[model samples]
Target: MKKSTLALISLLIVLCLLFVWAQNKILNYRTWFRVEEKILMISDRPEITKIAAMGFDGLVADLLWIRGIQYFGGNFSTLDKPEKRSGMMNLLRNLVGLDPHFLAAYQFGGFIINESIKDHEQAIDFLLDGADNNPLTEYPSAWRLPFDAGFIAFYQLKDHDVAKELFLQSIYGKKFAAVSVENAEGVKDDDSPEWLIDGDPFSSTRFDTSDGVFSLNLHDERQVGRVTVQQDSKRPKSYQLSYAADASMAAWQTLESVTNPGFYFHDFEPALKAHAFRFDQFKIQAEEDEEFSIAEVKIFGPRNPATPSYVERMAYEMDRAAGRFKAALDQYMRYYDEAVKKGDQVSADLSLQKLFDIYTNKCIEILQETAELYLQEKGSLPTAQMFELIQEGYLSRIIQQKITEEPGFVEDVAPVLMPTGNVWEILTTWDQKDPHLLITYTNDLGEEDWYITSRTRLIAEQKGVAEKLQQFVNKYKEEKGTLPENLSDLLNEPWFGATRIYEDPMGGEFFINRETGQVEARNPKY
Candidate 1:
């Protein structure tokens, strides 16, 4: 063989060896990436890492995302212990840093770490970062990232003002977005109710300024958006809505006037310092035989419903963090109700779910506390008085109205208590065992302009089942000198004025645990 040919073959062999060595090195680094601590150490400087990726930024981000999912999914069983998921958040942040448009990383990672690991601050940071980095052009009509951040601010952080601000940013681009009509608080005047209508049909006083005046009594200075009037008579007449900065002032400026009036809808720019408003006049009045009646009057404006003052936001957060549940409950419930009344379902639902969570979690907490006290004081499980104590001590009046009695209050702010066996039972049984159950319930009816606000309906039938079961359990203990052997024992002969107990709403058998004296809905179809 020629010497030149032999040298060429040797060079080729050397090149092949070098290629194999480089491949092995790459594989080693890939393996190291799977190790969370190593990922954390390497990902400490994301910009530097991105630079090192040699312009394959998206590819690098994808690889990191895969690793993050593996880490999250593999060890999710240990989610309760956040320490076990130490490097999960770092992995996600690094993933997003490489490719800011990797929205899935922001969404899943932000929610997972925040909800499961209880690192809400980091989760909120991820979401806010995504909101800032990914604009509407790239992620068109995508408001979720900012929305997620807003949720964390309101629900977890309990900062209402921050939540409101973030929510507005999500809906409207941060700069362009002012609080729109959907979010603005409803302006209601206490005296405005009495002034809405006056006098008998024959007297012709409904539209007469001397007899009665329709007005809005704003609690504070707010921006007025629109006013709607439904006249009882089909006859066309000119109607003018007037506004005044002060309720006491006689000077009135006409906000809107409609000549063709069947269902009058007048949209106008809000007064910057407007306070009180009233009906100016009704033109072309009907004869004494024809009575002018106004059926409904709806005034909409920018009342700033969910935007709490700094003091209120701080108080709520402090109370929630310190575990002052009743105070926290009151604050949350009021916010939820107010938001609903103002037609801000987004804020209302968010706050409503938080209220339920607080209520359920707090109830379980107090149950445990009361149970512990009973165990210490009387020993064993509690009796009738113990149940009574649970009702009175822990649970508040839970104000619910079947029929709304308050005048000028059109919306019903009742709790939308969905039928579940006993919420407390669900909490105790499935505290963190099932994460999906913790998801907030939405308005199944529809999304917009709900006459009855989207609230969890507390069904009477299901409530009876829970309460009856509790009574039966205590009764069994009293009569038999121990807990009943089975639920059938309590079902025997007119115990609840019937042979069998009430069926579970989910078409399951009502289950009673003899050991714990707790009731549950078991054997659900799905």
Candidate 2:
């Protein structure tokens, strides 16, 4: 060969070597990614906190940030400089996203991280992305996102409408996704005894993974794109078609010819709900794409249930509005309950949860009656007392009606201290004539409202604030050998710099009496 031809051949050889080296590096990086995941799992295995902490490093820090964002917006302020802004969220998201099986990334990164930091918008976005990206058993986690979101928004943000809507979406999504609607072991949805998923379409109670046999769930009426199949080697690749019925999940069924590789859905079906399908199994032969690698097949199909039904839509709306309200009630109720119990004297009917229901029920009654009331009178246009009186009225009705409808509904319910399991049983309210109590919250206008509010609002508002306050109370006792005489005295201490105010949701104020170290609500009903 000529000199020119020799040099050209050498150059080709060099290029081929470079390509091989680059490919190996990419493969090795993927292997490390898997290794890092294992490290993370070991780090977080609850039983190994101390051990995990020992091995924890920057990789663990990154994992925590990802987890933290879904936890409480990751409290990046606690993470130091650059890690705070590194789009760690997106990086964390990608890590959890592509795997789809890493449920923790979705729950911890998507929900816990977001909820912890109160990053509502991002939380929703991450969840939605997870919903679309998650394959196979995504429904449970996906449904939880909306359900949990609704709960958080309703309970924490005091936004009931959004909460209501999110719950509805969760319900509908579960149905369309073909998820089972059976009560998840210990879930307590107020309306679940009434709410249910509709649709079914399979007759064979028993099925097998035989190659010629195909199974499909036509839960939705959407065009299919591809499937990721997990198979038993003995059976090998099989071409199959599937469809859903009534937008229910338990209704997956097989339809047509089986194809190799991922499916490319043809003859699009656009009826109702989203569709999920796949081949029977994946075999080693299929992995090599010899005949066609197919393992744990999940075919991408058409979107089903394109629009929310009127009733479903209504439920969603209710959840949205109630979510924030419920969330606030939940947070405050816990804190306040702790404070009440600290004295070893319990507050009756004072749980934040009960207060929320009581207050909302009262609001409903007021709206129905078309009446306006005031702060000092028996009833007010919108005061804590007015809400309580109305709530009491509703309670009486609920009790009386239950006697007529389901007389035994409240029979098994026992009077418990605080944090009762059933929402209805959570609180045992103060007697109507009981003294008012102090509670506080940051109001809509961003001002702290503190007052001697009704037992209902007071109980709910104090739920979370007590933890921060308890530390102060404990410190005062530790330093002075007794409790602080006043809020001002606590403020003079080093740790009490910024927390001068203790406000409840309706804005009740806590006062410390000067004469005794004993801390009593200058008012007691809270």
Candidate 3:
């Protein structure tokens, strides 16, 4: 080989080594600078950073996200400082602003804001922004933003109304079609019934009297399975719903006679096929001075063929939360009972209060679910009287009576009122003006304690009743030398009354399980 060629090759190798050394020095300098500064070295303003990216927003966002994660980890303990927290949040906002599709950044940033920075309002706002930017249709995971926002609003911020809206958004996500009202029966001046079908839940239509009626013309016969009614403060106390095949109003089939109808959504079973529907016999006033007002009305066609995965997930989460609360309630009740048996007055008192709180939570959860169901079935909100009947386990009986009272009622095929298996006597008072439910509980000291319901609580009274029944059953078995054939056999005993065993708050018979000697109900309400 020629000497000139060999020398050139050696020079090229030397130059490559020099470049590698320079790159390493530059990386070391960057690390040293970051450590010394101990601050984010990026523009806080999202717009400024986006402009600086110059069409490389996505790449810039990725780099910022990595930097955010590192910064958050490093300054996590010091996030209590306002400046540090604000800096972290600014970085997250900039990252998402640059790449709105950055799902992980939004979720993680929400966590940082809520858990680390302890800024619940900002966390909710950030998450809702994420939900807005990432449409669920385009990105299925976007539902998590609203779901998490609802969780924070409910559990952390204690804002149930906001939480409910967020949860509904997460579940439904604007899937329903708007219904139009072709005609109205009772139009009073400016308050027209067209507002009822205007697709705005907040706008209301007022009627002059209780005898007003609203009619709908579907143009073409369609099968509708659900009817949602949103009412203002002046709501109907009772109403009749019917459907007909034609506009002639002859041979109208009665759907239901709803009393104390709460506002929201109502669902019908066995979808009705008709071109015309009528909402009449509206007994709107409990007092002579009151007026009737309805916000919106919706008639839904058949549901979608497939349920969204997010909806399924929301249901699962609701059930899981209920289960967790139920378990906690059961444990606390056990503690209360043990304390009582041991004659620990102080402990018993504490446990009793705790039991009230826990049960109130559970009742709130059940009550919310019940209200939703009632709105679907009865097309109204539950009143104090309705809850009183439910607590006395007389709701089903009253419903049965109403059905039988109707003309041409059949005896054999009359629908049976099934036991809900729920033994919790939720003695609640609902006010239409207020969105909250007020629950009254009398403690052992004979003082009435009032509680505002929120989410989940325990059913201590139900468990107490079951426990008492089980004790009686055990006594009967011990005396008779075998399990009784039926719970009715215990009724013959002096202590066992027929009313105690037969009358259930949830409208079911309580029976003794012969095999386990355990007290069980005929049907499970939940």
Candidate lDDT values, in order: 0.55, 0.43, 0.63
Off by over 4 Å in 3: 1-39, 174-204, 208-228, 232-260, 266-291, 296-526
User: What's model 2's overall lDDT?
Assistant: 0.43
Per-prediction TM-score to the true structure, in the order listed: 0.34, 0.29, 0.44
**Ranking of predictions according to TM-score:** 3, 1, 2
Clashing pairs for model 1 are: 185-303, 189-217, 416-455, 416-456, 416-457, 417-456, 417-457, 417-458
lDDT, candidate 2, at 259:
35
List model 3 lDDT by residue over 9-87, tens digit each. Answer: 9999999999999999998765444341225566778899888999999898888888888887776766756657667
Could you give me the TM-score of model 2 versus the true structure? 0.29
After aligning candidate 1 to the native by TM-score, how far in Å is the CA of 220 from where it should be?
A: 32
**Rank order (by lDDT, best first):** 3, 1, 2
Please tell me which model should have the higher TM-score, number 1 or number 3: 3
lDDT by residue (1-526, candidate 1, tens digit) is 9999999999999999999999999987754444545534555677888888899999888888777777777656555353456566566767888888877788987788787787788778778888888764356444678777877887888876567556645533343112211111222332223323232112222543334345555645655544546554445567666777774646778766766434454544332456666664555455654434555554544323233333234434544665645445656666677677779887778776667666556434434555555555655544322344335433222221112443211121112221242323322322333211111123447542111101132233455677778787788787778876667777673555656666664335777776688776677421
Candidate 2 C-alpha error for residue 332, in Å: 18
Better of 2 and 3 by TM-score: 3
